[model samples]
Target: MSKISAYILFLSLFLLAACDSAKKEFETLKEGEILLDINTEEYSLNGTVLGKTATDISVIDDVIDKPLYKELCDTRGKFLEEALGNGESIDIFELAKLHVDDNLSYVDFYKALSSMYFCGYSDFNIAIGTNYKDVFQLSIPRTDYMWCGLVIQRMKGLRYKYLRNRQKLSLSEMSEIDVEDRECVEEYKGLDLLLSFYRKDDGIAYVVSLNETFFNKGSRFDGYNFYTFNNDADLWKFIEDIRSKVDRQIGNMPGKKEDKVLRLLANAHGPNKVMLVFQKDVLMKDIAPIVKKLNTYGYRFAFDLD
Candidate 1:
């Protein structure tokens, strides 16, 4: 045989092997179950890694390591806009499947699954463990409108965090966070309005349902305490209240305005996440000042829905 012929045969065999491997990975995924594998050191779905795919050129505009999460919202929002034209609602799973292009990676697909809660697809049965064999087929019962459940399984350290309804949440759980026996949830009722999972040192997952009392009396959870704010005035008043509790000279130290403010605030409230709860009538213009101040001084803030 000629050298060129041998080389061509070898190349063809290699391509066939790669295609077979990709097919097996896809076959491992059951209906309604998303497999996000981190065994390749990068987030991979089936055999496609986010940055390794040709379609990932569009992801260059996104933040580092956060491209999928950002794209999850952007892509799903556009899909919802087109799917629900002049209609009140549509089947989420069907709409999602239709919009998923051949170029979509598994990481983006899993992130998209998590983003479904934003479109009111809340009910989910999440199970995270070491390998794909531990993942069960997600069975969502039919609701009055449609089926409303998704099962997400993380094979390894895929750094995806589902921030429920908020742009930023300090308490949100990242997919890679260690869990013995993947005890996050056997059957999470739903990621309804304010449902959150708080895992303690003892390895027990606590289902926290934040409500009006969280705003009125602040949150004291997991050995951390912090105040909540409904508006900019509430934030400033809390600042002033913190000032009153500390020594005047210390709180009003010269050349240390931001540091003094943070120190006193931390002293009054533990060094934990500060909650910002905007009332229904409050506009962005109303809370802009608070957000700016928090950003200016590097405050760890968490915004919650009313």
Candidate 2:
């Protein structure tokens, strides 16, 4: 055979082998689960990883090596010590608010953390320890709505804090309760608040729900159009103002109407965009008219998922 012919034959054989290997890998994946091709230039989801396929289930080495979990754990530990103190009697929810005000990044704190947990990069168990519920409340904060509950419960082992509404808490009275009790009472009042952090042998996850009432108290509107520019401050201010508006509107609405409205607004924004987080199951149908009113007032708007 000619030298060129031999070279061609070798190349064909190599291609055939590669094709066989790829096919075998593709066949091993399951439905619902996606296979990420981290080895290639494109991180394509070649096939399902969970439900059914032939791709072998193997952890991505690079994903396993992400230091985000460690960084988050360290940050949380420091935050806990500094904010709550070692044996200091302080409010957990308030501390969370303080952290949000002081250290949280505006671009993607919640979404990035959620992704890290979902991707198996962090150990949620170690990150949370005994404070899982409190962490969850602080992470998400809207538990009163039904839809928000669906999102929260889908993550792992998480429950919304429940607070019965009969107590009629004043603002100062509510603020003074211990973090855990405050979250519990808030939940019972048809307000869902959660803070979740979980870890297992493979990875870690952190989720928080912000108290809409508390968040709104700190938020303001600077009169920027929501449809244009997407100014960070303006966006945050609008959200804050919306929270206040929702609370007032809830007073007039009947039959769990308030929780529903809060949920819809919470679901509309991505983690970074969400200055306030709520429970997963709350209904949010009534807030549309209010949002329209804001739009009429010249607050431009856009929705983003982070």
Candidate 3:
């Protein structure tokens, strides 16, 4: 074939594949139903289609319940036991003494350290308390990028659930608009489950959209997340890193979900908080192992679908 004809053929194939990529991810899940398949890197975990959206998907993860908490407490405790690499217990009161680096002033260092260690994750018993006063708050210092000039590590599963108190921005307002022109995002052409790690002003955030992002035109979610991270550079880097990944498989595809559906109730909190909605034959399952796969890659979900 001539060079022009060869190029035309390749372009046609690419467009066709791009159009079908989103639909194909759905087809892969429904061996029968929208059976959820948590994807780690090794394989796909299949389950009935629990919840879906115009351009996103979600599976159940129940690492927040008590029985499961009881089951994993020893393991978590063991991890805590090895805190700071010294295998010593860290008391909350002594949190101000943590000296992670030279640049971190004692006050800012303590604040970051407290954000990491305080406000109980294990205390959650299917419901999040109504007050942000008790919630763990993270501060984003000025930086060239998300963490470039800041001396901090983004925490996985970290949440800034204060969206309930903040005013809700309509989908159009919250959408990430390109100042230059209508954004033509490079379509995600892979069938891999879309999981992402993000840095927000309030804390590190995680998102697992079906195949599109909150900013994608195809994404029809009515919700919008509140942002306190005023650093434009940081926000740019966060979204760019997600959009530019060579592949979206952030971790090993999860296997089977265990028994019981562990839930975190931001009870009084408005239900519109969750961006992706998913459900299944109700009951808690072992979310720890599957969640660990995402955490290993630094994506942790903190809210729930009520």
Best by lDDT: 1
Please provide, for model 2 over 158-187, each residue's C-alpha lDDT reduced to its tens digit, 9 standing for 90 to 100. Answer: 222222112222433334432223332333
lDDT of 3 by residue, 1-306 (tens): 999999999999997786566334433421111111211111111322322211121121332322222323343455455664774545421211111222212222222222323322221211011111111212222225343112111111112222323434333332333111113212322212322233457754444332234224354433333333344455445444553441232222232364112112111121112222122221222222233333343332332321
Per-residue error at 192 for model 2, in Å? 14
Task: Compute the lDDT for candidate 2.
Answer: 0.32
TM-score (all chains, Cα) for each model: 0.23, 0.21, 0.20
**Candidate 2 displacement at residue 272 in angstroms:** 18
**Alpha-carbon RMSD to native, per candidate:** 22.3, 20.7, 22.8
What is the lDDT, from 0 to 100, of the residue 214 in candidate 3?
A: 28
User: In terms of TM-score, how similar is model 2 to the real structure?
Assistant: 0.21
lDDT of 1 by residue, 158-261 (tens): 11233222333222333235333333433221111221222245542212222112222233211112233434465556554443433443344454655767
Q: Which of 1 and 2 is ahead in lDDT?
A: 1
